[model samples]
Target: MSAAGPILEVEAIQAFYGTIQALKGVTLQVNQGEIVTLIGANGAGKSTTLRTINGLMHPKAGKIRFEGQDITTTPPHQIVAMGISQSPEGRKLFPRMSVTENLEMGAFQRKDKENFKDDTERVFEYFPRLYERRTQKAGTMSGGEQQMCAIGRALMARPKLLMLDEPSMGLAPVFIEKIFEIVVQINKDGTPVLLVEQNALMALDVANRGYVLETGRVALEGPAAELKVNDRVRKTYLGEG
Candidate 1:
């Protein structure tokens, strides 16, 4: 792929949960090394959008292309192998597993031993808290620590496109700031990010570009700074004037 080509592309995608539509003709793109955000109210299908792209949820219609190949119907495992990884909403870490074990689980699809070791160190570098508590059970960790573990697990996959679904969901104000800062650092280090967040203001502030999801469709999109100043977005999503 060219340096300017989109790293991930979704075109006219419609996703569903057993007949109830969650994504209605949603389309978006993320370019190489950029941070992109999807922001909206609850039940606006932001999580579903991320899940569909990672193949956790299949779209009922349309296409998803990664690195220029069509992966619309690819299985979730295959999608992960193809370099897309998601830290899902709610920080779904395994309760009984040690943090290191959880991170190991994330690289299950890989057979390369050296790559796994390198990625594990990289994840710990990104979240030192995880490294310090590597031997502790994930379920015993605080919400913020668990979120860090979830992100660390995803990072263990060494993805080209990293998708985060509400990383700030239950974090304190301070942890929220820290998480977003780490996101920027990760993107700057060459992994493109697609963030799905209800914290619209924070998301937009960090993203290079953004798309506003409303009831499963995109109602607005543009550069992150531009959307931050958009009046309708301010009033409805950003909790601004």
Candidate 2:
């Protein structure tokens, strides 16, 4: 983790899905260059938390501060401009578009278009497969390849904080390992990440700190190392006795 202060702070935020609440007073923080993960089971509101932070869902109450500014109700595009980018749960790539085109969309908001090639090269360096399939349609690619493109797209944004939702979901074990390795490399290259994942063991392995959410509320919070060895965490999330 970098010495810089918290880049994002979610304070007791409550979010609802048309009156059926999804996030119950959730609070968490991601400091500069730190890999902070939110781990939970299905329907645990982990995705909701990320959506709220990204301004896709407005909080019913509480505040979200990014880089020390209040943005609880900011528009999603505006939030993206503020250096927060999300590679959402489904990868959400443009199925008909070529890999290069999909990457171009990620940098659509940048005024510095001249450096787009350089940025794309950097992403290719992270996932050589993307380079190999630069002209292929995104939807036609294998799952692992698509996943790499999704992450590569997010990197094109050059965000200060990257929020990933279930990045390792549905990939083979080898691809899962590869995805995590890229995550580590991304962090080492100076971008902080707020990861949401169902794979608790893998998330904890790469995260500097983690929060466990159960049924729309935070159930446990601690350093990643501590959580990995925690009796309750080990027994419940890790499937360890």
Candidate 3:
């Protein structure tokens, strides 16, 4: 947790889906207690970057380090155990499972089962709606509720770094605002977050720093407040001229 060092680092990583390269020497870092966001258009390799860090897809080149340890080739489960968890895009919930059950699945790798209840309760504190439907099937819930469950499930893993991929996708404006508020609250509670969001304005509003990705490379990066006013960023991403 040194002030000069990052908690997670991605160094010039290159990734591919089959033969098509999706990430081109992408590099970024998340310092301890910071919300660092990656904002980009569709197919800009934002999701690929998260998948690479979480070990769902290993990069053919470059490196990933978490807490100064190499996890470039670690398995997904091992990555989770190492304290990096991702609430993936698409809110991939266990459709038939109860909301509570889906949350428990996040803690499946925990060695200490005794604190499970406390962890679940903590998620309820963040999203009270989750507690109200704890016994309901995941698929029966609304999109925003399902997104809450997805984030709650990731938190159940008690990660040191939480990577959220498009948490605001498919939600109404009210729910979207609430989700971003919770994300900021989570960061305040001490978990560093690497958020990939299409809502550029909202993402920049909540993030401490941000990187703009395009095609497969980083186009711009700086403190979020600065980027929000940068002429290029405002015209391209923020829909301003």
Candidate 4:
């Protein structure tokens, strides 16, 4: 890993929807080769922060830097091509498209096709179910399978940084465990990940560091192990109270 600074940085970002401010000067970073997680309750601005960084929602204030370049105002597609790809919260796959076709759309913006076949094979390796259902329509797959395809599609972009939002949502417990394992393996393969998850226990278990958000502000931030043991976090998020 490069000893350089963080690959993705959000410096006091403030985002708004209409007149409602969702992010209150939120600042975070994902360094190379690390899995950093953002854990929070509903309406804590986790997804909004991602939307802002991915250029789906430009912040009214603050700067976003990816690999040391300013991308606060960059377009979403440009941001993806610049190596920041997201598998959003809802598993937003092309329902009518086959698993292979949906994966193809993920690489639609890539200028390099030399590794297309190799990358597809890698995705299949990660989600063997996708391989079995490669020709099936994404919408017709089970929730877990669709989630796998959504993540697989994001991987097809060959992102330098992968951002996943609520990846474990609406899935069976078995699939959740499997998903987190794959997430760790993905990080091991050299792509830094920014995870926004509702499962605080699972998120902190696999994360190197974590941030806790409340009402759009960072309530606490620390090493994942530390956060996992924090009194407040235990009571509220971990169900340890």
| Candidate 2 error regions (>4 Å) | none
lDDT of 4: 0.95
lDDT of 1 at 10: 98
The per-candidate count of clashes, in order, stands at 0, 0, 0, 0
* Cα-lDDT of candidate 3: 0.95
Q: What is the C-alpha lDDT of each candidate?
A: 0.91, 0.94, 0.95, 0.95
Model 1 per-residue lDDT at 203: 96
Error of 2 at 73 (Å): 0.5
Q: Which prediction has more favorable TM-score, 1 or 4?
A: 4
Per-residue lDDT of candidate 1, residues 40-118 (tens digit): 9999999889888888788989999999999998999999999999998898899899999999999888878688888
Candidate 4: segments with Cα more than 4 A from true spot = 1-4
Better of 2 and 3 by TM-score: 2
Q: In terms of lDDT, which candidate is stronger, 2 or 3? A: 3
Q: Candidate 3 regions off by >4 Å?
A: 1-4
User: TM-score of each candidate?
Assistant: 0.96, 0.98, 0.98, 0.98
Deviation in angstroms for 117 in model 1? 2.4
Deviation (Å) of 43 in candidate 1: 0.8
TM-score of 4: 0.98
lDDT of 4 at 73: 99
